[model samples]
Target: MIEILSPARIERARDAGRLVGTILRTLARRTQVGTNLLEIDAWARRMIEDAGAQSCYVDYAPAFGRGPFGHWICTAVNDAVLHGKPHDLRLSSGDLLTLDLAVSLRGVAADAAISLIVGEARDAQDERMIATTEQALAAGIATAGPGARVGDLSHAIGTVLAGAGYPINLEFGGHGIGSSMHQDPHIANTGRPGRGYRLRPGMMLALEPWVMADTDQLVTDPDGWTLRSATGARAAHSEQTILITEDGAEILTLPNP
Candidate 1:
């Protein structure tokens, strides 16, 4: 369902967004070589509880994902991208990691994701892929505003990723997020401008741009939740929950500088 949040509800959403941002930043800092994916999930649960917030993934059940996600955070490493279910794996140096989180506070929800390299080692290609996704995310947010078409944001994001020579996947993308982790108004990573749903003040949407290094095809892992590149190519994903406003869009989930 499409929801246009009320002013007071927007304030609640801001709080949710803050919690999501802070948790993601903390997780990124704590993650490193030798870190266990399960430990990361445990950390997320503690943080959410301490803040008196709720984790959207703990009980997430959808047709696409295994029922009751049973994890506090998504820990995607290297080839893994979206819906990465936390598992028993210790990260290694230079591993490209993506952490996607969604939390609900005071009944409003916010979602965001970040991609980073674990440990001291970094590959040039991995760095470039992550940077491109971040750039695409920024471009998409810049296109959101009252009266703007969803396609405008998609086009803006697609331009950045496609220009970087990465293939775009439409199987899963961003979506409206508020009160729940996923909602209506599906936002594709690539689309024609001046098409799709029209934006209005008080609307909140999550714009995520993800890409595979060499292909657009995805293969689901045996876990039934984690999605990986078909060619085992490294992947990167970036996202933010934005609040549509009269003049522009307010990015609710930006990590501290």
Candidate 2:
């Protein structure tokens, strides 16, 4: 399931990537204290429909999750990290929130995620958690390019998280993405260099670096989808969809003006 985009297909990918980036930015702006999680999902639904794009998560039913995600975006808050299913909770000041989104436009899909504090209060620990993930993501992207190994990207990501004193979780990480949301060549957050799949031009990869404050263990919420830290410590995650090119890796999902 490793998809390599043709020249024309790359254009469609960019379109989808832009849509994802714009939608995320819009959602981030709208989020604040007292905003309900469900409200955010509804907003995402409207924006995706207006753009004539499809949500990769709305109808998603994977083995690890309950049937049909039935949500437009993943609203992970505080201790919650991955596969966060939006619920009735209202955001409060100082809440660390992560929004992960993916959409298909013109048959190509792009995925990305961002973590930030909800309001004016920026806890030092929360800021460190978010910064570490962002730094790890940047490092991963910097190591990506034609002929580079997946391990190289993983090592780059691991160095940042480890240096920041955060435990790395391998249960979920980045992966190949294209026509469908998740694809082959699983990219772990930490690994040895010069190992795993080799990079090639026209290939697309979603490089995500996520970490929990205290432990690497995760617990599934009662909803059967949201993954939270076992120790209930704050967490953060960062992601972007990148396209492998002959020259280097091109980040497709960046916020639009």
Candidate 3:
């Protein structure tokens, strides 16, 4: 279902978006070498509760996943990318971790994801992968104004990833997000411009551009939720929830302070 927010609803969305961004930034600062993935999930739960918000992922069960997610946040490390279920693994230096979070505050939902290196040791390839995703995300956001086709956003995102020599995966991408975490108008990482759904004011979209270092193929882990690169190469993902306004797109999931 596609949801368009009214002016007042947009305000509520901004609040939800800010909360998600703040929680992600807090988690990024707290995560380091020796930190357990479960601990990170616990931290996220506490933050969400303290803010009087709900986690969109906690009871989320979709066809692709095993069952209810049963977690507050997604912690994907190194080869793991999307739908990363938190496990017993402890983060180590140089590990590339992606934190994907979505929360509902006052009945509005906002989703965002960030990829960062765990500790001091920074691998060049890992850094490049992370940077490329971020760049692609920025490009996608830049093309998200009203009247812009979903394909325009996809083309902008795909240009960055392809230029960086990374393959694009269409199995999972961005989508409309509002009262729920995932909604209609699927936005791929790469596509032909001037096609697909046309943007309109008050429409919110979560544009995420993710890529594996060597392959576009993905393999589901034994856990049935975590999706990893088929080649076991490092991966990165970047995302933001944006609202299409009359003049342009407003990014709701920007970090606070």
Candidate 4:
């Protein structure tokens, strides 16, 4: 369902957003070569508990996934992109990693994701893919504001990724996020501008732009959750929860500089 959060609710969302950002940053810093995927999940659990917050993913069960997620964070490495279930795997140098997280605090929720190289730079293409996703995310956020249509943001994001020579996948994209991790007003990564739901003040949305290096097709892993590139090409994903305000869109998940 679409939700226009009240001012007090927005404040609660901000708190959740900050926590999500901080946790992702902390995990990125702690992650390195030989780091186990399970270790990252464990760290996220501790942090969420210490903050007296809740993990949106731990017990998440959706039709697309295999039962409960049973993980505190999503650790997608290399070919893996979205809904990557944590497994018994250790990261190695040059591995491309993506960490997506969501947390609820004070009855509000925020979601965000980041992609980076695990230890050392392996291929220049990997860096380019990551940069493209980041750029697309910024473009999408820039298009969000009062009276703006969801398609406008999607078009902005798609233009960036397509221009960067990456194929866009529509199977899964951003969505409305607030009291729950995922909500209504499905935000596709690419669409025609001046279409879809119109933006309004107090609306919160999670805009994510993800792409595979070579193709738009995706193949699900045996785990029934992780989505990988059909061609085994490297992929990158970037996302942020934004609040629509009178002035413009305020990115709630930005890391403190």
Every candidate's lDDT: 0.93, 0.94, 0.94, 0.93
TM-score of each: 0.98, 0.99, 0.99, 0.98
Q: Per-residue error at 19 for model 2, in Å?
A: 0.7
Question: Global CA lDDT of candidate 2, please?
Answer: 0.94
Candidate 2 Cα errors over 4 Å, as ranges: none
For model 1, residues 41-123, the per-residue Cα lDDT tens digits are 99999999999999999989999986788999998989999999999999999999999999999999999999999986577
On residues 21-71, what C-alpha lDDT tens digit does candidate 4 reach at each position?
Answer: 999999999999999999999999999999999999988999999889999
Per-residue C-alpha lDDT of model 2 across residues 123-223, encoded as one tens digit per residue: 79888788889999999999999999999999999999999999999989999999999998999999999999999999999999999999999999999
**Better structure of 1 and 3 per lDDT:** 3
Stretches of candidate 1 off by over 4 Å are: 255-257
Worst 10 residues of 3 by lDDT: 118-127
Compared with the true structure, the alpha-carbon lDDT of candidate 3 equals 0.94
Q: Quantify how close model 3 is to the true structure by its C-alpha RMSD in Å.
A: 0.7
lDDT of 4 at 202: 95
